[model samples]
Target: MSEYFNTQALALSKSFADAAFKAHTLAVEGLERVTNLNLKALETNVAATVDFLSEAAEVRDFDSLKTIFPKGVNLVKDSAEKFYANGQEVFGVTVKTGEALSQIAKGSFEVANDSFKKQVSAAQADFSKQVNGAAKKATR
Candidate 1:
């Protein structure tokens, strides 16, 4: 009886530990992905800014300004397009992370539910057997 209880306790403890670990792993992965996305976006924007500044610095006179103005406009347009694309990519990552986390949560819940059901059924059977044994002893 002691051994049985010990085994059950160990099993429950292990299940809880496993569930916690899985949840932690999923959270970390999602955070890492978001961080990477933000970092990439920041890096791209910084590089674009540096390049634009360098081009603008080259403009010294009215004729040079005229030549640089169209290029500056094009640069702005290109930067806007890049930012739009990056935003889309970030959105995609966010959606994927959400779905992945949801699945993890759902799967863990189902497993825990099944484990609880099985434990309850087993306990009920054990209780019934013990009661039957006590009744036989009383009759004897």
Candidate 2:
């Protein structure tokens, strides 16, 4: 009986450990996705800013300034679109991570519930056998 209980306890501990590891792995992957998206956005913005500044620096006369005005407008429009696309991708990754986490939680809960039920049934059967043997010995 003691050995049976010990084995069950160890199995439960292992199950919990496995679940925690899986959760941590999912979180780290999600963090990496977000970090990569942010870095890409930052790089895009920096490049656009540098180009704008370079153009502005060359505008020494009215004609040069007029030439850069349209370019500046186009740069702004392009940057806005890039930012919007990056934001949408990040949002999609976040949603996918959320769904993955939910599935992990549900799977873990179901496994634990099933293990607990099996352990309980086994313990009940062992107790009944022990009781019957004790009663028979007492009568003899």
Candidate 3:
């Protein structure tokens, strides 16, 4: 029955491959969900941070520039939301987006990786449980 064994082995290989493919697809979809949620959250945080800093940067001096030609930006009257660089002042709210974008980009990458792994593990576990249930029923 060597031929029989060979046929069984081939079938087993194909089945295993199919299972793995399905698992991968499920994992990827789950990862996307996690990414979407986190991305939305980050976008909100960025927007909020920009608004907060815009109202406070003049006091914080975040632009890293704004001392040489201090002719226009009056620190006292301007809304507390201002940033400067090289002694040059700018709208603090504008630059906060770039910083927020960077943070979200980096954080999203890490978060996606972690979520992918967790989802893969969960998919595999669920697949194994179903397979085991079938085997148990067949044996019974």
Candidate 4:
């Protein structure tokens, strides 16, 4: 009876440990994805901004450039703001998710550690009992 209970408890403890590891892994991966995607988008935006400046600078005529400048500036402003807003939104979501996952992992670790300590103590007690029983039998 004791063995069976211990076996099932062990399995439950292992599942808890696995859940903890998976939670941590997901948090790390989620953060990485958010950071990578934002960096890539920002890089593209910067490059495009630089290209726009270069082309605008090369304009030989003010009337022609003026004809183009307003639309170009507006386009850059609108699209860049959208990209930055999206990056912020995604980054915030990832941070929140990661924090929640981290908390779950921490809780799981505590539960697993407590279960392990109990299991070890029970095993030790059982060993002591068996040894005392055997010595008494031998003395008799």
The candidate that achieves the highest TM-score relative to the unseen native structure: 2
Cα RMSDs, all models: 2.8, 2.0, 17.1, 5.9
Reference-based TM-score, model 2: 0.86
Candidate 4 ranges beyond 4 A from true positions: 1-14, 17-68
Best by lDDT: 2
Each candidate structure's TM-score, on Cα atoms with residue i matched to residue i, is 0.78, 0.86, 0.41, 0.56
The segments of candidate 3 whose C-alpha lies over 4 angstroms from its true place after superposition are: 58-140
Model 2: residue 41 alpha-carbon error in angstroms = 2.0
Clashing pairs in 2: none
Q: Of the pair 1 and 3, which is ahead by TM-score?
A: 1
lDDT: worst 10-residue window of model 3: 82-91
In what order do the candidates fall by TM-score, top score first?
A: 2, 1, 4, 3
By TM-score, is 2 or 4 better? Answer: 2
The lDDT for every candidate, in the order shown, is: 0.79, 0.88, 0.51, 0.77
Runs of candidate 1 with Cα error greater than 4 angstroms are 1-13
Worst 10 residues of 1 by lDDT: 1-10
lDDT of 1 by residue, 20-60 (tens): 78778867887788788778878987887788889889888
Ranking of all predicted structures according to lDDT, beginning with the best and ending with the worst: 2, 1, 4, 3
lDDT of 2 by residue, 1-140 (tens): 78667877787788878888998899899989999999989898899889899879978999998999998899899889988999999999999988998888888878877887888789889999999999999999
